[model samples]
Target: MALVNDRFSKWATGFSGCDGGDIGSPHSKSIWYCGIEWGGGHPDDEHELINKVLSNDVEFPSEGYTSDDSPPGWLYNLAYRFNWQAMKLLTAVSGDSITSYKVFAEKVKPFTKGEKGYFKMNLYPLAFVNTSHDLWKNGFAKATGLDTKKDYHDWIKANRFPIMKTWMDTYSPKLIICVGKSYLPEFSLAFFGEELTFESEIIDDRELSWAVNKNGTIMVVLPFLGNRNGLNKNVSIQKFGDRIRELLTTL
Candidate 1:
């Protein structure tokens, strides 16, 4: 069963609207990494309780959002597919070799909360087992005043997108990596304040979409890193990361 307490309640209060804060540094030059949403919000899964609690506890105290180091079942654990692959991509993009696990453990440092060079967050605030799941309907309805996921999404598009734009204006990040090419509109509107036209190229038969704005922030849309159709293969992810690095140099 989903665990709810004072902490969850307090977190939901701020998280229910356009003010849902991010999970990493607010550094002006940080690389902003935007995901679809926080995963694993199923009310029935006991495994997600720790994730829920820790997510609530995350804070950005003028430095960056701080998170505890990987606990065994934590979502940030390197054992998790998403976390691992994300690290690999970041490592590769940094022009480092990804063949060694030490790239994450030593060099790139995945999920070290409050990281200065990286900023992590989601377009939507509420968590889910997957994007399509509506199990959070009841929980979010009470906190956000919109029940159906569709309504909440619409509300976020209207309200939250502007706040995101303000953040982009304020921080001026060097790179914005948005996962899920399907949410291109959301990412474009949120970060660039307009619909961005992406140039697509097929690498190893997997499509990689990217765009560069006049302000020097490059936006890239990649398939989900952990999903079935995601860039899970080492070769494909490495190639994509290299392409992103190449794009970064032009700016």
Candidate 2:
């Protein structure tokens, strides 16, 4: 069965915070992982506070209130989860360059409790969308105990992969930057076949980057960035943007 966009929508709805009542029906073109739900608030409840945060209109403390009435620790938890997912993608795309997990964390933290919450929300969704195929073929469900019925892989393959693939095939971007190392091998195997060359240069005990190109063609596996050394700390957002531009130039 071919994947379609709607099926991916359904799969995304299966997550802990994706209940439809508060979020309403997601649009086919709406940012799938951009984090802005229709009704606002956490996935479970609709609160004015949540709406404000989602809209990027949140203020540190409401007008007269001394402290926020928002759920205690929920904001932090949400931020942490979002960062984790982004890290996953970053590692997959960048490999050893991801040494500064803290860098990624700090970069994403400011967006957590603001109108850009959707940005934080979509990090995982985008990662899932980009890597869903590799994950399923590689037995990620079995290893992680993620229910095939509800997880992104099952849902995307059933619904969205075709659309995404069409987009990628058309664009054929040269560098696919993933944020976490954990996702690299699986992604490589799924997209480029199992026999492809993987030349690894280890950065530390926990992470390394393997460089490979598809059939001596345009596509190349750049280094996977991980959270390790102060790389994240040292690299500025402008520098990251420059890196992305540099990668695009190769394509």
Candidate 3:
């Protein structure tokens, strides 16, 4: 069965506030737990927005827009065209929260090389990877104790990989960048057929590491760009984004 939702979510323009396990909900139980949350937005200007993201300049909204006057295609612009820089740069990510997706993209924006764009990375279809959507939602628990590291690892492979495999197969991105190095083993095992090795390198005086899947998709390990922290502690995430951009330039 097709695991990713081809339909643009009902909240395509913004976050859907529905809680889990509801009937006829935009976020169906299946999607709440497993569907690829990115893509399928069916943006109003797919080609135009994509071209901007690819060749011209694309910028994230300084903050969420509340005015009804906000352009309808902004969602397509922010979320897909430019907002999620990591995913845009590498084309695949395993994130659960919409906030985190937006944060990382924003954080990386300032660090981006120029007003024009961030990285010269290839794009791919089918880009979200929640690992387990049920894990991050508040006040929610799972059949497995998703909070535990061991249990989390178990859940991702047993429940999430099949869905991810379907997505990876469908899109076949040239790279799959993971937030936090913790998942490299599982990620490598799932998509690359074995435990791929990584090499650490210094870029712009900062250090980072990455791996490559046998399928030719480069796998990068980065800090979680949530509200808290990212690749560097002493530096702001904006700077961290710049550092990583320099590192990726080498890759």
Give the number of the best model, judged by lDDT: 1
Q: Best candidate per TM-score, number?
A: 1
Local distance difference test values of all predictions, in order? 0.65, 0.33, 0.35
Worst 10 residues of 2 by lDDT: 19-28
Provide the clashing-pair count of each candidate structure.
0, 33, 0
Could you tell me which 10 consecutive residues in candidate 3 have the lowest summed lDDT? 17-26
Q: List runs of model 3 lying over 4 Å from the truth.
A: 1-153, 204-207, 226-229, 232-251
- lDDT of prediction 3: 0.35
Roughly what TM-score does model 2 have, to 2 decimal places?
Answer: 0.34
| lDDT for each residue of candidate 3 in 102-160, tens digit (9 for 90 to 100) | 55444433113222121121111112233343333211112112333344345445544
RMSD of 2: 12.6
| Residue runs of model 1 more than 4 Å from their true location after superposition | 1-28, 42-77, 110-114
The 10-residue segment with the lowest total lDDT in model 1: 15-24
**CA lDDT of 85 in candidate 1?**
75
lDDT of 2 at 198: 52
- What lDDT is reached at residue 239 by model 1? 91
What is the descending lDDT order? 1, 3, 2
The per-residue C-alpha lDDT of model 3 at residue 169 equals: 52
lDDT, candidate 2, at 60: 21
